[model samples]
Target: MSLRSLFVDFNSYFASVEQHEDPSLRGRPVGVAPVAAETTSLIAASYEAKAFGVGTGTMVREARRRCPGIQIRVARPERYVVWHHRLMEAIDHAIPVGRVGSIDEVACELVGRQRRREVAEEIAQQVKNEVALAAPGGAIRCSIGIAPNDFLAKTASDMKKPDGLTVIELADLPHALHGLELRDLCGIGPSMEARLHEAGITTVAQLTAADKHRLRHAWGGIEGERMWGLLRGAWLPTAPTERGSIGHSHVLGPELRTPVGARAVLKKLLVKAAMRMRREEMLSGAMAVRIRFIGHDQRWERDLAFDPTDDSRELLRLLNGVLDSGNRRHPLPGPANATPLSVSVTLMRLVPRTQSSGSLFAPTQDTRRVDALVDRINNKFGYNKLYFGSMQLALEHDAAPMRIPFNRVPDTDSENEAGHDPLWLQSLNRFKAIAEGEHRRRERGGKGN
Candidate 1:
């Protein structure tokens, strides 16, 4: 078999982007956190910090203890999204991107002479060069891996470091992967590792040795069989899936951890999610809310199933009921006391607007017109200028800002700009068109030829 896939993984993506932009952070231990509080965990860490046992998921205070000089910076999601787009545009010039695994990973399909080991390596080098030239801040490095299939190529990419290139020939098969831990492989998180261990798959070697039947039993599905084949360099095609849910989660900063503040942030996230759902012409059939307390071991969660609708008032009313129930069961503390650390709201069980036949109590034409008018006002004025009254405190404190996720590129015009000028908004809409187009191309060709 020839090398058919090439994978690229950015090193400490969020932290590296921060270091690249700021000269003082270069060559120093740096940790990036969503909230700049000691209680918060680092979302990304520079390679220098990794040497001192400080990395992603390390608490800010713990990181400071591990490396006294470590610098903590708040995450700038907008900058990361901008850099992601710039990097992708540059890499597309080098080779065709087959799929985007996440914000920091990309898989490319190689054909004919490009599949040869030497030629693939050269192309990988070209990609690195392109990134360097494209990045305006500094040299943004990446690790490249080449293998017979996308899975093995992704595995190879994880085996290296910043700017490293590695090749995994088919001849090596499972033996080449024996040295790595189960968690090092893709899709094997802590929970999956425990499940594998229960099935006597404590290591990569044992995992590879397990039969398809055994792995299926362990994984409880065909996903196990896919892993069984991928270990031997077998190619498995993956297709893009339709969106099943829209949600947002935010880690509250120290000052915004109060009960009132938590409610406001959650309200903002829900409204933003609802707007996005309406933009896609979809209605939610169910809503779920989760609130995690700062010091409590137990979290508060509530879920409700309702008639499918995109009416914000209906959704808000349902959400308010859920919150009221939770509050009655367990009273929230005062502003100075322990409160929610993070909150998330998800709108799931969705259906297209065309398929949704409203019930007797569905929102009326007048209500629909009002919602449309509100949407127009926001589009013309600003995203947060005319938000629901409940979200005012959170909005004033700059909580629950819009963020771009891996699966979807959000509207930059709505989030990035302060003024919503018609001409500028049109230009930003064009930029969004390009971004959404790029994301769709990757989605269509996910890990498949």
Candidate 2:
């Protein structure tokens, strides 16, 4: 077998982008959080912060304790999406990008002369150079991994640090991976590790050496057999799975922890999810809402099944009913004293929207016109230009910017255009101005008295 795939994984993606956009943050410990709250957890941490035992999922206060001088930045999803496109173009100059594994990872297929080890290494170097040149101030870096299959290529990419390149050849097979732990592989996590241990496959070597049948039995499915193939440098055919659901979750900031605020967030989430479902031409028959309270193990959840529909107003009504039921079953303490940490809305039991037929008792509201109008306005003016009145409270708050999932890229045509909406630009500028003004105010206040 030869080198067939090249994978590039961005290092400390969000933090690196922050540093790239701002020169002063280049070497400082930076932590990116979804919200500007001390209690929120870091979604990404810089290398400088990592040295002090800070990482994703570490609370902001703990990160500050670990690295006293750490700078915390609220995440800007739009900025990350912009950088993703730039990096992809940079890599495309070296080799046609075969697949975008996620926002922070891309893979290219090596063919013909490119498959040669020397040529592959040269292309990898070119990619690194291009990425540095494309990024603002040359602050972004990536780790490149060349292997016979995408899975192992991704695995090799994680073996090193910023701006590192590693190759896993067929000759290196099972023994070369013997020193690595079970979790070193992409799909193996803590739970998977425990299962592997139960199956007498505690090490990478043991996992690679196990029979496909035994592995399948251990996994209770065919995924183990696929893993067995991937471990041995086999390039398996890709199979696409239908999307099962559309959902969104938001981690509430300190100020928006009340029951009313949580409901507002849930409303916004449902609207977003419904919009996406309509865009994808999918209809959902069931909906569920979940709420997690701060510092509490118990969670509140409720689910309801209804006639399949993609109408946002109808879905909102159903979702509100679910929330009301949940409140009655597990009443929230007063908004003043109790805090809900997060809320999620999920739309499940989906089918093609085209398959949905009109119901005899459908509400009299002109949902189709309302939805079409909302989509048109958002498409022209940017997201959240026209939203439900119920979501007014959470409108100013970040609707928890959507993150691109590992398997897909978001629709970026309008967002990536040169002449994107001026309204969105104005909003961004206003936010920046307010932040800068606050910083200056703090500095002047410190200097006084």
Candidate 3:
């Protein structure tokens, strides 16, 4: 009926976190990349770097050419995760957080008196103030938006950034969003934009005015109808669907460009995926392996459907079999001549471990125990500390660091060895203290009432 949702989006999340962590990095242009390699692309750029036309997907060389003094830092995913939790705690001080849209965005639901525009704006401001306090030197800032639904709220948050607050009232309707391009809306990427154009919906106004039937036809699915409802300020359900698959992909470094190196990387990836699947208590019914060759259009993929499994050894065996069969059909380029660009492994048709029945092909109980023991040892010591000998070639390479996925947050267990700061632990403690203080204050206020 009123402003039912509030969305908060961090501006240049990774770069901001780096600047916040190091006071010297503040006010300077910074870019975060997966690796320190000159050929790597920046995953995020600070606003100052953005002034020089540097941005995500800009190669490090190009970014340096644009901003001669640009600073490039390797991504610290664990630091980002720590800050995410802290920011969520800060927002929770104002209102209960609803859904975490990503590492840098969160949505909160407003109910009762909180739904009033005045109250909603007050909560937004409080959230901003808390976030500033929680961040180091008050360096982090967020844009907040309040609207009738989560979709519009997210769009409004993006309208203005770097300490912005916007409210999209229902009374404003389609006119309020007319100034934005169709791509400004979430889910409207280049391909979707082309489809919208083919359907005679080239503008936000056209999209807003599109009939549900026409939208469904344009999208070729129910998603179009859902978009139509969202455009009209109707709230849509946010329930998650069952996960379809779990996979990991890696862009090979120069050292891993050979077939032997690529296979080693693939083995590492499958082991990681298998560990994750075991953690989730999920079994995979099928598996797929893909390899992309450098300087050629020859992409090789192999898929195999077998009894459900989460054992790393069994999955690796199956993956090796797939690779063997693929090589027999189409021999890989010579070890010295070929250059592999990337490799990926996907575990498909997942089912709950509890729902899976014993299969003749499944590993024996002793094998399962061995796998569990390895997982425990790795978890206790460090990742890859007890990996299979087949992955020895990739031993020096770091395990692909945990990254936030679209539907869920990844749990990372990073050890604080020499030279590494305990910032994550400190941040966690601060969050807990703030939460406890808030709880006590609420209790006292309740008694007073």
RMSD of 3: 12.0
RMSD of candidate 1 to the true fold?
9.2
What's the TM-score of each model vs. the native?
Answer: 0.88, 0.87, 0.88
- Local distance difference test, candidate 2: 0.77
Q: Which stretches of candidate 3 lie over 4 Å from their true place?
A: 293-299, 328-338, 413-449
Q: Write the per-residue lDDT of candidate 3 for residues 163-183, one digit (tens) a residue.
A: 899999889888999999998
lDDT of 2 by residue, 161-226 (tens): 877899999999988789888888887876788888898988887888899998998888999899
Residue-level lDDT for 138 in candidate 1? 54
True lDDT of residue 180, candidate 2: 89
Compared with the true structure, model 1 gives a TM-score of: 0.88
Kindly report which residue pairs in candidate 1 clash with one another. none
Q: Alpha-carbon error at 290 in model 1, in Å?
A: 1.6
Error of 3 at 314 (Å): 1.2
Tens digit per residue, CA lDDT, model 1, 1-449: 37899999989888888888997998999998765578666778899999999876676787899999999998776677677778888899999877876667789999989988889999999999899898755537899989988889999998889778989998887899999999889888767999998988898999989899999999999999998998888878676888898777766777887778888888888888787788779999999898766444456677899989999988889888887764364444222245566777999999999988966789999998888788777867778667789898898888866565435444566544311122222222323333333333443466356
Candidate 1 residue spans exceeding 4 A from truth: 136-138, 295-297, 326-338, 414-449
Q: How close to the true structure is residue 446 of candidate 1, measured as C-alpha lDDT?
A: 66
The lDDT of each candidate is 0.78, 0.77, 0.78
